[model samples]
Target: MARLAQVTSSRNREVVAGFDNYADAERAVDSLSDKGFPVEHTTISGVGLRLVEDVLGRLTYPKAAGLGAVNGLWIGLLFGVFLALFTTNAVAWFAVILWALLWGAVVGAVAALIWHALSGGRRDFLSASQLIADRYEVLVDPAHAERARELLQTSQS
Candidate 1:
Protein backbone atom coordinates (compact mmCIF):
# COMPACT_ATOMS: atom_id res chain seq x y z
CA MET A 1 0.00 0.00 0.00
CA ALA A 2 2.78 2.43 0.92
CA ARG A 3 4.62 1.50 -2.22
CA LEU A 4 1.51 2.15 -4.28
CA ALA A 5 1.15 5.73 -3.05
CA GLN A 6 4.85 6.36 -3.42
CA VAL A 7 5.07 4.96 -6.94
CA THR A 8 1.91 6.66 -8.17
CA SER A 9 2.95 10.02 -6.78
CA SER A 10 6.48 9.81 -8.06
CA ARG A 11 5.52 8.81 -11.58
CA ASN A 12 2.89 11.57 -11.81
CA ARG A 13 2.35 10.96 -15.51
CA GLU A 14 2.44 7.47 -17.04
CA VAL A 15 0.29 5.43 -14.72
CA VAL A 16 -2.81 4.58 -16.74
CA ALA A 17 -4.55 2.96 -13.81
CA GLY A 18 -3.66 1.65 -10.43
CA PHE A 19 -5.85 -1.12 -9.05
CA ASP A 20 -5.58 -2.56 -5.58
CA ASN A 21 -7.60 -5.52 -6.65
CA TYR A 22 -7.09 -7.65 -9.76
CA ALA A 23 -10.40 -8.30 -11.55
CA ASP A 24 -11.28 -4.67 -12.14
CA ALA A 25 -7.72 -3.99 -13.15
CA GLU A 26 -7.78 -6.70 -15.77
CA ARG A 27 -11.08 -5.44 -17.07
CA ALA A 28 -9.58 -1.97 -17.27
CA VAL A 29 -6.80 -3.26 -19.45
CA ASP A 30 -9.19 -5.28 -21.64
CA SER A 31 -11.47 -2.32 -22.04
CA LEU A 32 -8.73 0.19 -22.71
CA SER A 33 -6.98 -1.98 -25.28
CA ASP A 34 -10.27 -2.65 -27.02
CA LYS A 35 -10.78 1.12 -27.25
CA GLY A 36 -7.48 1.45 -29.13
CA PHE A 37 -5.59 2.71 -26.12
CA PRO A 38 -2.73 0.32 -25.91
CA VAL A 39 -2.24 -0.66 -22.30
CA GLU A 40 1.23 0.59 -21.45
CA HIS A 41 1.70 -1.79 -18.53
CA THR A 42 -0.07 -4.13 -16.16
CA THR A 43 0.92 -5.01 -12.66
CA ILE A 44 -0.58 -7.90 -10.73
CA SER A 45 0.07 -7.96 -7.01
CA GLY A 46 -1.29 -9.88 -4.02
CA VAL A 47 -3.58 -11.61 -6.46
CA GLY A 48 -3.88 -15.36 -5.99
CA LEU A 49 -4.40 -15.82 -2.26
CA ARG A 50 -3.09 -15.29 1.26
CA LEU A 51 -2.74 -17.86 3.99
CA VAL A 52 -2.24 -16.57 7.51
CA GLU A 53 -2.22 -18.95 10.42
CA ASP A 54 -3.26 -17.62 13.80
CA VAL A 55 -0.53 -16.70 16.27
CA LEU A 56 -1.75 -19.49 18.50
CA GLY A 57 -0.91 -21.86 15.70
CA ARG A 58 2.70 -20.90 16.20
CA LEU A 59 3.08 -20.32 20.00
CA THR A 60 1.32 -21.48 23.10
CA TYR A 61 0.90 -17.87 24.18
CA PRO A 62 2.25 -14.39 23.79
CA LYS A 63 5.41 -13.47 25.61
CA ALA A 64 3.37 -11.16 27.79
CA ALA A 65 1.84 -14.26 29.30
CA GLY A 66 5.01 -14.42 31.33
CA LEU A 67 4.19 -11.00 32.69
CA GLY A 68 0.96 -12.41 33.96
CA ALA A 69 2.90 -15.07 35.78
CA VAL A 70 5.12 -12.43 37.28
CA ASN A 71 2.09 -10.49 38.46
CA GLY A 72 0.55 -13.55 40.06
CA LEU A 73 3.82 -14.20 41.78
CA TRP A 74 3.87 -10.67 43.20
CA ILE A 75 0.32 -11.03 44.45
CA GLY A 76 1.20 -14.31 46.07
CA LEU A 77 4.13 -12.63 47.77
CA LEU A 78 1.88 -9.92 49.16
CA PHE A 79 -0.46 -12.52 50.49
CA GLY A 80 2.47 -14.24 52.16
CA VAL A 81 3.42 -10.94 53.78
CA PHE A 82 -0.06 -10.64 55.19
CA LEU A 83 0.10 -14.18 56.51
CA ALA A 84 3.45 -13.59 58.17
CA LEU A 85 2.40 -10.26 59.71
CA PHE A 86 -0.92 -11.39 61.12
CA THR A 87 -1.05 -15.19 61.18
CA THR A 88 2.48 -16.55 61.50
CA ASN A 89 4.57 -16.51 64.67
CA ALA A 90 7.82 -16.11 62.68
CA VAL A 91 9.29 -12.63 63.07
CA ALA A 92 11.68 -12.92 60.10
CA TRP A 93 10.57 -11.09 56.96
CA PHE A 94 12.66 -13.63 55.01
CA ALA A 95 10.12 -16.25 55.94
CA VAL A 96 7.48 -14.08 54.42
CA ILE A 97 9.46 -13.76 51.23
CA LEU A 98 10.00 -17.52 51.06
CA TRP A 99 6.36 -18.25 51.62
CA ALA A 100 5.57 -15.65 49.05
CA LEU A 101 7.85 -17.42 46.57
CA LEU A 102 6.08 -20.71 47.18
CA TRP A 103 2.80 -18.97 46.56
CA GLY A 104 4.20 -17.30 43.49
CA ALA A 105 5.23 -20.65 42.08
CA VAL A 106 1.75 -21.97 42.72
CA VAL A 107 0.31 -18.94 40.97
CA GLY A 108 2.63 -19.35 38.03
CA ALA A 109 1.72 -23.01 37.78
CA VAL A 110 -1.94 -22.12 37.82
CA ALA A 111 -1.38 -19.55 35.11
CA ALA A 112 0.44 -22.04 32.93
CA LEU A 113 -2.45 -24.42 33.50
CA ILE A 114 -4.96 -21.82 32.44
CA TRP A 115 -2.99 -20.92 29.32
CA HIS A 116 -2.63 -24.55 28.33
CA ALA A 117 -6.35 -25.00 28.71
CA LEU A 118 -7.07 -21.95 26.60
CA SER A 119 -4.69 -22.93 23.82
CA GLY A 120 -5.45 -26.65 24.07
CA GLY A 121 -1.67 -26.90 23.86
CA ARG A 122 -1.94 -25.78 20.24
CA ARG A 123 -1.62 -22.02 20.15
CA ASP A 124 -2.72 -20.85 16.75
CA PHE A 125 -3.91 -17.58 15.27
CA LEU A 126 -6.79 -17.05 12.86
CA SER A 127 -6.15 -16.86 9.17
CA ALA A 128 -8.41 -15.31 6.53
CA SER A 129 -8.58 -13.62 3.13
CA GLN A 130 -7.33 -16.70 1.41
CA LEU A 131 -8.08 -14.91 -1.83
CA ILE A 132 -9.71 -11.55 -2.44
CA ALA A 133 -9.79 -10.11 -5.95
CA ASP A 134 -13.47 -9.50 -6.43
CA ARG A 135 -13.07 -6.00 -7.87
CA TYR A 136 -10.49 -3.74 -9.43
CA GLU A 137 -10.03 -0.02 -10.16
CA VAL A 138 -9.64 1.29 -13.66
CA LEU A 139 -8.14 4.52 -14.87
CA VAL A 140 -8.53 6.13 -18.25
CA ASP A 141 -6.54 8.68 -20.15
CA PRO A 142 -7.77 12.23 -20.69
CA ALA A 143 -8.72 11.37 -24.27
CA HIS A 144 -10.38 7.92 -24.25
CA ALA A 145 -13.11 8.02 -21.64
CA GLU A 146 -16.06 7.43 -24.00
CA ARG A 147 -14.12 5.07 -26.21
CA ALA A 148 -13.12 3.01 -23.18
CA ARG A 149 -16.70 2.75 -22.06
CA GLU A 150 -17.86 1.75 -25.52
CA LEU A 151 -15.19 -0.88 -25.82
CA LEU A 152 -16.01 -2.34 -22.45
CA GLN A 153 -19.70 -2.45 -23.30
CA THR A 154 -19.06 -4.13 -26.61
CA SER A 155 -16.69 -6.63 -25.05
CA GLN A 156 -19.21 -7.50 -22.36
CA SER A 157 -21.90 -8.15 -24.92
Candidate 2:
Protein backbone atom coordinates (compact mmCIF):
# COMPACT_ATOMS: atom_id res chain seq x y z
CA MET A 1 0.00 0.00 0.00
CA ALA A 2 1.46 3.34 -1.11
CA ARG A 3 0.41 6.58 0.53
CA LEU A 4 -0.51 9.62 -1.57
CA ALA A 5 -0.59 13.24 -0.45
CA GLN A 6 -2.93 15.81 -2.00
CA VAL A 7 -2.33 19.57 -2.03
CA THR A 8 -4.69 22.37 -3.00
CA SER A 9 -4.06 23.98 -6.40
CA SER A 10 -2.37 27.36 -6.50
CA ARG A 11 -4.20 29.98 -8.52
CA ASN A 12 -1.24 32.34 -9.03
CA ARG A 13 0.90 30.07 -11.26
CA GLU A 14 2.39 31.50 -14.47
CA VAL A 15 3.98 29.85 -17.49
CA VAL A 16 7.68 30.75 -17.81
CA ALA A 17 8.57 28.67 -20.87
CA GLY A 18 7.01 26.41 -23.47
CA PHE A 19 8.57 23.65 -25.61
CA ASP A 20 7.54 21.42 -28.46
CA ASN A 21 8.17 18.38 -26.32
CA TYR A 22 8.48 17.22 -22.73
CA ALA A 23 12.27 16.67 -22.86
CA ASP A 24 12.93 20.34 -23.57
CA ALA A 25 10.59 21.43 -20.80
CA GLU A 26 12.32 18.99 -18.43
CA ARG A 27 15.75 20.36 -19.37
CA ALA A 28 14.55 23.90 -18.70
CA VAL A 29 13.43 22.91 -15.19
CA ASP A 30 16.69 21.05 -14.54
CA SER A 31 18.65 24.12 -15.59
CA LEU A 32 16.66 26.23 -13.13
CA SER A 33 17.42 23.71 -10.35
CA ASP A 34 21.14 23.78 -11.18
CA LYS A 35 21.13 27.62 -11.04
CA GLY A 36 19.92 27.52 -7.41
CA PHE A 37 16.35 28.47 -8.31
CA PRO A 38 13.52 27.14 -6.16
CA VAL A 39 12.48 24.40 -8.65
CA GLU A 40 9.69 23.21 -6.31
CA HIS A 41 7.58 26.17 -7.46
CA THR A 42 7.64 24.88 -11.04
CA THR A 43 5.47 22.35 -12.85
CA ILE A 44 5.47 20.82 -16.33
CA SER A 45 2.14 20.51 -18.12
CA GLY A 46 1.25 18.99 -21.48
CA VAL A 47 -1.07 20.76 -23.93
CA GLY A 48 -3.16 19.52 -26.92
CA LEU A 49 -3.23 15.88 -25.86
CA ARG A 50 -3.86 13.06 -28.34
CA LEU A 51 -4.27 9.35 -27.95
CA VAL A 52 -2.01 7.30 -30.19
CA GLU A 53 -2.12 3.54 -30.66
CA ASP A 54 0.76 1.84 -32.43
CA VAL A 55 0.20 -1.62 -33.80
CA LEU A 56 3.19 -3.85 -33.18
CA GLY A 57 2.18 -6.90 -35.19
CA ARG A 58 -0.51 -9.45 -35.87
CA LEU A 59 -1.50 -11.70 -32.97
CA THR A 60 -1.96 -15.32 -33.99
CA TYR A 61 -3.17 -18.29 -31.97
CA PRO A 62 0.30 -19.68 -31.43
CA LYS A 63 1.59 -16.31 -30.31
CA ALA A 64 -1.19 -15.87 -27.81
CA ALA A 65 -0.59 -19.35 -26.36
CA GLY A 66 3.12 -18.66 -26.01
CA LEU A 67 2.47 -15.31 -24.33
CA GLY A 68 0.02 -16.89 -21.88
CA ALA A 69 2.43 -19.75 -21.14
CA VAL A 70 5.25 -17.32 -20.39
CA ASN A 71 3.01 -15.32 -18.08
CA GLY A 72 1.74 -18.48 -16.35
CA LEU A 73 5.26 -19.87 -15.93
CA TRP A 74 6.27 -16.85 -13.84
CA ILE A 75 3.10 -17.01 -11.77
CA GLY A 76 3.54 -20.74 -11.18
CA LEU A 77 7.11 -20.24 -10.01
CA LEU A 78 5.98 -17.61 -7.51
CA PHE A 79 3.20 -19.78 -6.12
CA GLY A 80 5.50 -22.82 -5.98
CA VAL A 81 8.13 -20.90 -4.03
CA PHE A 82 5.49 -19.64 -1.60
CA LEU A 83 4.07 -23.12 -1.08
CA ALA A 84 7.49 -24.66 -0.65
CA LEU A 85 8.41 -22.13 2.00
CA PHE A 86 5.60 -23.27 4.37
CA THR A 87 5.67 -26.98 3.71
CA THR A 88 7.43 -29.22 6.27
CA ASN A 89 8.33 -32.00 3.81
CA ALA A 90 11.71 -31.01 2.38
CA VAL A 91 12.04 -33.83 -0.15
CA ALA A 92 8.75 -32.99 -1.91
CA TRP A 93 9.65 -29.39 -2.71
CA PHE A 94 11.01 -30.08 -6.20
CA ALA A 95 8.09 -32.37 -7.03
CA VAL A 96 5.57 -29.78 -5.89
CA ILE A 97 7.17 -27.03 -7.99
CA LEU A 98 7.42 -29.21 -11.09
CA TRP A 99 3.77 -30.24 -10.82
CA ALA A 100 2.65 -26.65 -10.48
CA LEU A 101 4.69 -25.58 -13.50
CA LEU A 102 3.31 -28.34 -15.74
CA TRP A 103 -0.31 -27.65 -14.76
CA GLY A 104 0.10 -23.92 -15.17
CA ALA A 105 1.38 -24.24 -18.74
CA VAL A 106 -1.41 -26.58 -19.83
CA VAL A 107 -4.10 -24.47 -18.19
CA GLY A 108 -2.72 -21.26 -19.60
CA ALA A 109 -2.66 -22.59 -23.17
CA VAL A 110 -6.26 -23.83 -22.99
CA ALA A 111 -7.49 -20.60 -21.47
CA ALA A 112 -5.82 -18.48 -24.14
CA LEU A 113 -7.19 -20.60 -26.92
CA ILE A 114 -10.71 -20.33 -25.49
CA TRP A 115 -10.45 -16.57 -25.13
CA HIS A 116 -9.25 -16.11 -28.71
CA ALA A 117 -12.08 -18.21 -30.06
CA LEU A 118 -14.63 -16.24 -28.04
CA SER A 119 -13.33 -12.94 -29.40
CA GLY A 120 -14.66 -13.92 -32.89
CA GLY A 121 -11.65 -12.29 -34.54
CA ARG A 122 -12.63 -8.75 -33.62
CA ARG A 123 -9.15 -7.59 -32.56
CA ASP A 124 -6.33 -9.86 -33.68
CA PHE A 125 -3.41 -7.53 -33.43
CA LEU A 126 -1.02 -6.40 -30.73
CA SER A 127 -0.71 -2.68 -30.07
CA ALA A 128 0.43 -0.12 -27.53
CA SER A 129 -1.42 3.06 -26.55
CA GLN A 130 -0.01 6.37 -25.39
CA LEU A 131 -1.27 9.87 -24.68
CA ILE A 132 0.90 12.51 -26.34
CA ALA A 133 0.83 16.30 -26.33
CA ASP A 134 1.70 18.82 -29.03
CA ARG A 135 3.55 21.01 -26.57
CA TYR A 136 4.81 21.16 -23.00
CA GLU A 137 4.87 24.27 -20.79
CA VAL A 138 6.91 24.99 -17.67
CA LEU A 139 4.86 26.94 -15.11
CA VAL A 140 5.98 28.50 -11.86
CA ASP A 141 4.48 30.32 -8.90
CA PRO A 142 3.84 33.97 -9.90
CA ALA A 143 6.47 35.28 -7.48
CA HIS A 144 9.25 33.03 -8.86
CA ALA A 145 8.23 32.99 -12.52
CA GLU A 146 10.47 35.91 -13.46
CA ARG A 147 13.54 34.45 -11.71
CA ALA A 148 12.94 31.10 -13.36
CA ARG A 149 12.84 32.71 -16.80
CA GLU A 150 16.04 34.67 -16.10
CA LEU A 151 17.95 31.55 -14.98
CA LEU A 152 16.80 29.60 -18.04
CA GLN A 153 17.80 32.43 -20.39
CA THR A 154 21.26 32.76 -18.81
CA SER A 155 21.85 29.01 -18.99
CA GLN A 156 20.96 28.98 -22.70
CA SER A 157 23.49 31.75 -23.37
Pick the TM-score winner: 2
For each predicted model, how many residue pairs clash, with residues at least 3 apart or on different chains?
10, 0
Model 2, residue 56: displacement in angstroms? 2.3
Residue clash pairs of candidate 2: none
Top lDDT model = 2
Cα lDDT of model 2 by residue, 92-148, tens digit: 888778777877787788788788888989899899999999999898988898888
Model 1 ranges off by over 4 Å = 1-58, 61-68, 87-91, 121-157
Lowest summed lDDT window (length 10), candidate 1: 9-18
lDDT for each candidate structure: 0.57, 0.83
**Residue pairs whose backbone atoms clash in candidate 1:** 24-136, 54-125, 54-126, 55-125, 56-123, 56-124, 56-125, 57-123, 57-124, 57-125
Q: Compute the lDDT for candidate 2.
A: 0.83
